[model samples]
Target: MEFIARATAVVGGAVALVRRIGAPGHQAMGPSPQIPEAKAQGIMTLKMPVARGWKEGHVPTCAPGLAVNAFATGLDHPRWIEVLPNGDVLVAESKEQAGPPRTLMDHAAQATMRRAKAIGDSANRVTLLRDANGDGVAEVQEVFVQDQNQPFGMALIGDRFYLGNTDGIVVFDYTPGATSLTGAGRKLVSFKPHGHWTRSLIASPDGTKVYAGVGSLSNIGDMGMEAEEGRAAIWELDVASEKARIFASGLRNAVGMAWEPATGTLWTVVNERDGLGDETPPDYLTSVRDGGFYGWPYSYWGGTVDDRVKQDPALVARAITPDYALGGHTASLGLCWMPAGTLPGFGEGMVIGQHGSWNRSKLSGYKLIFVPFANGAPAGPPRDILTGFLSPDEKLAYGRPVGVVVGADGRSLLMADDVGDVIWRVTGA
Candidate 1:
């Protein structure tokens, strides 16, 4: 139970490039093989693996690196997680679930359904956990904010915790040694609920600005969802003044985000538009330019336009291509930059936790992948770092990985498995 088996296989045959474990001076480059799930099984029954310390790749097997294990089990529908300066983990347990799959072909109509779902009170919650004794495993878990319509994204600033709720944004202050919200949360800002429901949060390195990811109300203009109406955007808010503006636009659904160390670039793992048949428009990872506009509704990848929306000329011309596309419907989320290429070796790596897709006939993405880079961009193709959370037969998924963060121990990583309702500690290889 303490051993980690890292089986990294390519998803396609060898291309022009194989990703390198890179360094600070990378210029970027890429290639691959297709691997089936059976080749990467971490034991058969995947009922949320029983953790016996850090049973990750590398290390001397799964030994206890830290004793304080952060528990997120009671988090109802947690979609994101964060670690504060004091080491407390904030869990954003979103109560919203799409009211069944809407017709992807419908642009405006489906957006309505998404908005309605965000307003549902069933899945909204915010909680905190603490392992005060440096034991690594959490002994205290408590609700910091509750009874909100549906909460998704969160960021901690000084003494306050900012939340991205269904209809708007709010905040609660924190006190060391405490784990729950004490006083009433102060409303910070608001935006009308659109058809889509995604409120992811990230803060600037200096905490001067706060970032929020609000997904488009519709996919690529279906049902007439205009881009200006809050579809696919990264919003920037002034923390000191509380002013807001559209930081970047047309990101489809930027699910997870982090700041890169090499160049301090803002990186995002985005869930691109769906329904282009399987493998049409790849999900992508890219650096967010201050006012950059990513492609949506009208165009994708580079210059590929969706014929489905050709009639709308205005929307078509404004779209911008993505950095590099991920294969269709991967639902990419929860991203972090890894300093090591493999265990004990300081190679360049980007780690992303795919939340898995239900739309594709052949299910995909229920685990983690390593995107090795050469200089500063994706060096080669992606490889599976942590798989087996999804059944090969595509019938069931034991867990849906949401957020990933470098742990208290600099050697390993921590993952939030939302479906299984637990946070897993994974050491390097």
Candidate 2:
């Protein structure tokens, strides 16, 4: 592992190419999007920012009139977070599991994963943190659940708590204030495992059903479309019947999902295909429709055909265009809606966490941003809320922000920094 990590670093530095298009934000966030032409590369880009641990007294920078503090630290690769009704936060401390490599590309991907500190044994546990006194810090912490597969997303519906594991959805009986769960809950639905393994789960507004986002097994169906069976789409499951069906298709990898409060519509942030330079087929945030196809391997950004994949004119014609573009290769993963008046200057907007780019020469999206909305649609440009994750040279990353949510109190924001192993709380100054 050490040899592969060192080799990837040395080779990546020598072969990586920088972005020709200056900044990614200019092409992002408008109604009529301007997607740049694709620049196809002969070799896969190997630009990964090295992860650096934060200094003891350091934290992320905040926007003016806002303050940032560490809510909890010393976690094991915390990737996603969920807030309980009782002011407790549950964090899924997980790492990706290794699979056998079938080709040279797979070996190269594994080496890159090691260099990025992305591959290892899964911690397979969830930790609970409580901020009893209303301060931004967690006063008490405990292991809420344990001994599971790579868990990513979570949701609580009445007395039942749903956990989205890489291979299936598990459910458990819940008591509000309890610290731990006793047994491995029943499997509600089993999913087919593939390359993209993080299952993002959410419940319906009325709590009658659960929705799980299953990403594609390979980029552009490189592993064959048959392997993508039951993958790369959002699966809607009935809580009572344990029945599941595809609600939407061709999403590629819809990592973050939330229900738009005003219109009661579902929205998601998807990570698009790579190896198409740094600017084409921008990652997007869009309203998800039932039985809708957003175009994955066949097309991108709504009907822009990717020549790499086998052409399917009929499928491309049916692709629904996304509501907003988030920039190419931003890896935009986390999504949450803040109610009106939650924070001053930012009124009723969506907070998205860009996990940063590994395929681009220059990094993008290692920070948290806000997109203001009016009447259930984006109304203005995105604002940077938390930054300083990347160094000025863009070669080192201190942290990568992932799951973000509006705090239970409704006045603060909570973000899970996966690479930093810390959860940060932000409040108005």
**Per-residue lDDT of model 1, residues 38-137, tens digit only:** 1111111111121122223311112222222334355555677777777777777774544544433232223322322221345567777786785556
Model 1 Cα RMSD, 1 decimal: 10.4
* Local lDDT at 95 for model 2: 84
Best model per TM-score: 2
- In terms of lDDT, model 1 sits at 0.61
lDDT of model 1, residue 80: 74
Q: Which regions in candidate 1 have their CA more than 4 angstroms from the true location?
A: 1-74, 98-121, 226-228, 310-318, 341-346
